[model samples]
Target chain A: MAWTNILTDLLKVNYPIIQAPMLGVSTPEMAAAVSNEGGLGSLPVGGLSPDATKQLIRTTKSLTNKPFAVNLFAHNIPSYSEDDLEPMRKLLLQLAAKRGYDLNAADLSNFKLYNYLDQIDILIEEKIPVVSFTFGCLDPDSIEALKRNACTLIGTATCVEEALYLQQQDIDIIAVQGIEAGGHRGTFIEDMPLPQIGLFSLLPQIKKAVRIPCVAAGGINSARTMKAAVELGADGVQIGTAFIGTEESQAIPSYKTRLNNAKDTDTALTKAFSGRWARGIRNEMMNEIEQAGIPIPPYPLQNSLTAQFRKLAQQNNDIEYTTLWAGQSAVRTTLTQSKDIIRNLIEGYEAL
Target chain B: MAWTNILTDLLKVNYPIIQAPMLGVSTPEMAAAVSNEGGLGSLPVGGLSPDATKQLIRTTKSLTNKPFAVNLFAHNIPSYSEDDLEPMRKLLLQLAAKRGYDLNAADLSNFKLYNYLDQIDILIEEKIPVVSFTFGCLDPDSIEALKRNACTLIGTATCVEEALYLQQQDIDIIAVQGIEAGGHRGTFIEDMPLPQIGLFSLLPQIKKAVRIPCVAAGGINSARTMKAAVELGADGVQIGTAFIGTEESQAIPSYKTRLNNAKDTDTALTKAFSGRWARGIRNEMMNEIEQAGIPIPPYPLQNSLTAQFRKLAQQNNDIEYTTLWAGQSAVRTTLTQSKDIIRNLIEGYEAL
Candidate 1:
């Protein structure tokens, strides 16, 4: 039972841990460092163009020969109208003005996000060893094509129903993301009630219901949490927030600092930042936006609107306006090299 | 590494499982059945008279010399005014009329709940082997007196903050009650953000922060769940739903059937039931009461008022009027003798 589960054996990693494919935060260097340290590293190709996806895949391959995963967002594109986008835009403009930026409402219009079909083409063509999808599952045709290419597929499930549905589609692994996880929720339904179960409670329920390996994700930033995940029947553990401050992680300095300064009780779930529920550390902007009761548009529209505001705020050290994505355990992580973090995880597992 | 943890050693039980002290559901016979089968069973003394609490303790002891636990509520009794009572009385009267009873608003006027100080006297005098409390921690005097009596004190905590607070009070065990738990939430601060972390997430956080044994509770009703609890750093498990159908359990026939017919998605948290949020199956009363958006009074008043209504409804075999407390895993539990359920748990843990 010493790291002899299907996940480790299939991924060819020494420890049953995965560097969670964090969209804006993970870099090729970071993924390489984790893979070099005997844990599976991941690069997110979720929202990139096919060419960009291929270029990053090549960059990562050159950096490390060890196994790594490529992640994609397979969510159905949400439709919205002008009426839906007004309040969120109004709030965003006001926040930008307070930050001393002459931001306009039109800059956020024409939100665009296509599904991962083209990205899948690049991954299959490049013979990518592992592929993970969040937000929703792939259709039967895509599932067949990936299987033919010898890709080990991973799907994200926030509830038992989603896990079982993913299992029915015959995926390789299920990343059981609890409600406390950072960034976007991997929920499939647009209006489904948030399955507010925590990581530990959710992991076992999914593990018991499905036969596939479960990669427990969400607030897993420490050795104790990792150990608890393993003991609770996780074949592997996926970590995100803990790697925010590493040399290779792509988060801004202030974002890293905010995460570093956080405490156990600091994080909360808000659709305010991206119009999709995700956990993050609370700040002035979040408080103002949430308190205003501004109805946000769907994912890509509200996300696109806030994207520019977040970037400009980060550039000026104006954390009050940034969407600081972080898990509940964001405060407990140490600032270090990604390799050292992986080494510590192995040490912690052995110590347990 | 085995069942050699503080909770098992202190309780002198063979298995690391404790049938939850469910008021109105657990009987002296149920407690004896569990203790006799080598797990600690608990009797809840919440709002009970000192004499009645003593009588149940004696009855439990008569059935089995094996170790058992006595539980009490440690909540601060809220002060209410006539303004608060008027709205709740209106709702109760309307509900009673629908159940074919001529209920008056004054029936719920005299809301009363005696504190745990008197119950502690009986527990100490009788030398109850184990004692647990919920809603809040015991004060200095009660803790000191309980320690003097050498009682193994267990405190319920829904969040790490509460667990740390309980740790400072020098409790013997921390029952990590997750948000998915049935009945009342044992939160101390009414305004504190509900630490919605599941048992797995909360257990490790508590285990990492404290030195005492942690007993995982909530939605743990099956062998798989019990095993999962043990693997995730739980020294013991406090189960409620699974034991509801046991021969020794005191639940009514229709209530037991409702539990049997429940699904994983059947439960919802409603303050309408007891004025404190607790998860249970949605029914005719729950649907009607919830839809009305009735502003409930504080704990003892609303709880006391509902008690009479539930009693009358049960006598008439009316399922719509009774309060049925059940966890998320209610559907998975089956009707059986309590001893057999205990045996299954032991077998499940060993198999793991």
Candidate 2:
């Protein structure tokens, strides 16, 4: 019944629970708070520049001596000319204009896509103890570099085949994401539709196939869910939506409020926001895009196009227009501090 | 942790496991074998005639003296003219012709849809102890008639709202079907897409809201999954896919072979086979319908149209053309006797 296991020993945390590195919401303060409270706090640098990643890691280190993780986006950046993005750009502009937001062509342009390779040296130099990546696995060179630093590498998988592939590539651990997860899907397999296996079904199969520790991600917010994941043979639980409403999270107030008020059925998967499937609370923007039946451009292209529009919506505190990323268990989220959240998890599990 | 909870006590079973009433695959021999092994066996009469239902119940009774459940489909049959069925009928004919199966117009007609209301009296008169239903709830008159006989009533729910509704109607137990469940979805709420909440997310939410005993269904095949469900507060479990490969199951040899060979990602939700959404192994027929982007006629209509084609394909043992209903945990299934499957489940849970 004790939480101590291979994952806890490897990450050097008291509990096997991990705060998910949510790109738009996770903050240095949040990661430090979790790590300081004996859980693995993750710093999401998936969308950040190397300088920003360095600054964030330094700030987190200043706040806590406990171990933490740095997360990166390892997906291949799609090649596209400016002309290829014109149609979606015009559509986004028109949509923004209808909402009384002034978004120009320049607002959607000039966005640079960062490769995970560019940020590897920062992790190695900073002596980051843990590194996790989603959307795909890290390259061999980067893996070798991280391995040289003795970093505990975690790769995210949405199915058994992906978990096997990650283990074969020498990942130290695998974070198996379920369909109930929020944000982007970690499916990297090509020529197939997205694998939407839930945590209950995906965990045991992945555990049976892989030798490395497997952490269950998605829909794990409470101690009951955590224990359930453990019962299904998970080494640990990677929690996201539970921490998104915490005081230290950088998620906008409107997003937090939506998370607080949402129900189990309120969240759904949509590719309209970034052209990659992600689970979030359904809103006007998602509904409009789906109703219009327009084909969304692939990942970074669509992500870049919607950048300014999301920013403006966030600034205006518009819940309907901004991306309100949350998992299916958003109803379990509470707006509390990070330390209290981790404490409640541990205490709840112990009481059970 | 004892399996003797409110559910088992109410249903007069030794264990908290219920064999799912899969419409096409469940058989009296299978149900009785499970009942004889101290599990709650279920005879699925959802698509059977009143005479057939009575015969199945009598056969099962002759095989075992233990308690079992009879399942019914309670949805309103759509009122469609013969003209409404012509186009879909013609399409099925063309598809069957391509597969070298001879079919005439008369072969497709004369398939009668049975109303659950017509089957309630049979249960009352036969003194059946347990009745479960899916697709929708039974009418008030039918409920009163069954309750008058002191029969235990179980209703299927795909979301918390549906679970709450079932509780309000005084259902003795709720078979909370997750998106990972096979066969037809039990979503009855109007103006919404099918609620695809997985067991990991849906179980805790439904358990928190309803006062009745909740039996977790969908993607639960092994002892680990069974324990996971119990940890998440399910009073019992209703298993389906685990029994598809049983020697007593009425599933075709090709279907059982496919189930034995399937992985976690092989099953997907498709509304193409029937008007209503159901999970099954992806086949050429599903791909063809999806690729053609044709609007399938609603249930019973579409069910009738494709009935002959599925039958012909099964007769020829062609896996590609038959409906292979399975849950996400199909990989865990094995070809064995129903009694052995129950014994393995009990032993597995005890070992854990």
Counting clashing residue pairs in each candidate, in order, gives 0, 0
Q: On residues A141-176, what C-alpha lDDT tens digit does candidate 2 reach at each position?
A: 999989999899999999999999999999999999
What is the Å distance of residue B38 in model 2 from its true position? 1.1
CAPRI quality level assigned to candidate 1 from its DockQ score:
acceptable
Relative to the real complex, the DockQ score for model 2 comes to 0.85
- Which runs of model 2 end up more than 4 angstroms from their true locations? A332-335, B332-335
lDDT (Cα, 0-100) at A72 in candidate 1: 91
lDDT of 2 at A157: 95
| TM-score for the A-chain in each candidate structure | 0.94, 0.97
lDDT score of residue A207 within candidate 1: 85
Candidate 1: stretches off by over 4 Å? A12-15, A190-192, A219-231, B12-14, B99-102, B219-232, B316-321, B330-335
Query: What does the lDDT read for residue B316 in candidate 2?
Result: 91
Per-residue alpha-carbon lDDT of model 1 for B321-343, expressed as tens digits?
87778776665455588888888
